[model samples]
Every structure is written in structure tokens, then in C-alpha cells.
Target: MLNIRCPYCEEDRPEIEFRNAGEAHIARPDEPDRVDDRQWADFLYTRDNPKGWHAERWRHVHGCGRFFNAVRHSVDDRILLTYKAGEPKPDIERMLREREA
Candidate 1:
């Protein structure tokens, strides 16, 4: 059972209370009507499905009902950290470096 902390609620809840929304920080095009078909399709369908560390969006569906970001390891199914929506993505490389010091 994965214990996930909701950034908004500030409570560690069971994984069943949350839902993985998808990748985080995908910016929408400035002009939707002007976007080419290929570009538009890429934006909608493409994702960086990394096998290792990944930054993703999650919603505390049963709790706060707010969306947040989480850094997780795909292979291990471990969530490293969770942050509020609209917050800048964490600097993972820098964090790892700091952890080693």
C-alpha cells in the first residue's frame, strides 16, 4: 500500500484515495486553431513514459479533490515526493547531488 501525502490537505493518505492523472507540466499551444494536425496530435497523445524517475500529476480524489505533482519511480512504484499544482517541477538531479553530500 502506497502512502501518498496530499500537498493541499497535508495528510498522508492511502493510494486508493488518489488517482494518477498523467504527465505534469505540459503546456498548451498558444493558438489552438493554428496548430498543425501533427503537432496537435503529438501534444494530445505523446508522453514521456520513462522507466525510471518520472514527474506526474495526481489527484487526491477521495480527500482534498485537488490535483498535485508527484515524482515517482516507475519500476519500484515509489513516490519520492508530492508538490502543489502550478509549483515548478523539482530539480531532481540537484536533489540527488545534495543527498549524496
Candidate 2:
């Protein structure tokens, strides 16, 4: 069974205790009224489906019930790390280099 570490809980738990919340770091428009319909639609619906390392939001639904972010490998389904929400996004390039060393 796949285990996910909940940054908020500070422990690894079974994957079933968590839920993928979708792509991370998505920011809302500062002026929603100024954006056209197409822009609004794009913000609501558009997401990247990259084949490699991807940053994503996840929730520890059955544990802390809090949300966090994780860097995961989309192809191999490996979660490299998890961090609390509102933190700055980690440098993926540096992390991958360190991992390969």
C-alpha cells in the first residue's frame, strides 16, 4: 500500500487517508471583474498534465483533515516530499539533482 506523509500531521499514513486536491499554486485573478470570460474559464478549467515531476495539492482527509502540497512523480507515482500549504514552492530542479546524486 502506498503511504503518504502528511506535512501537517508529520507522519506517513496510508494513501487511502488522503485525497489528491489537484494542481498546486494556482492563483486567482486579482481583479476578477476585469478578466474576460475566456480568461475566467481558463483559470477554472485549465491544468497541466506533465509526465514527470509535478507539484500538486493533497488533503489528509482521514487524518489531520488539512491540506498540503507535494512534489510527486506523475509517471512512477512517487511522492518526493510534502509541505504545508501556503509555503513557497520548492525548487524542483535542485531537488531532482540532489536526488540523483
Top of the candidates by TM-score? 2
Residue 15 CA error for candidate 1 (Å)? 0.3
Each candidate structure's TM-score, on Cα atoms with residue i matched to residue i, is 0.94, 0.95
- Provide the lDDT at 5 for model 1: 90
Instruction: Write candidate 1's Cα lDDT for 1-101 as tens digits.
Output: 89999999998999999999999999889999999999999899999999988999999999889999999999998887899999999998787789799
Number of backbone-clashing residue pairs for each candidate, in the order shown = 0, 0
The regions of model 2 sitting more than 4 angstroms off are none
lDDT of 2 by residue, 1-101 (tens): 67899988889899999999999999999999999999999899999999999999999988889999999999999989999999999999998899899
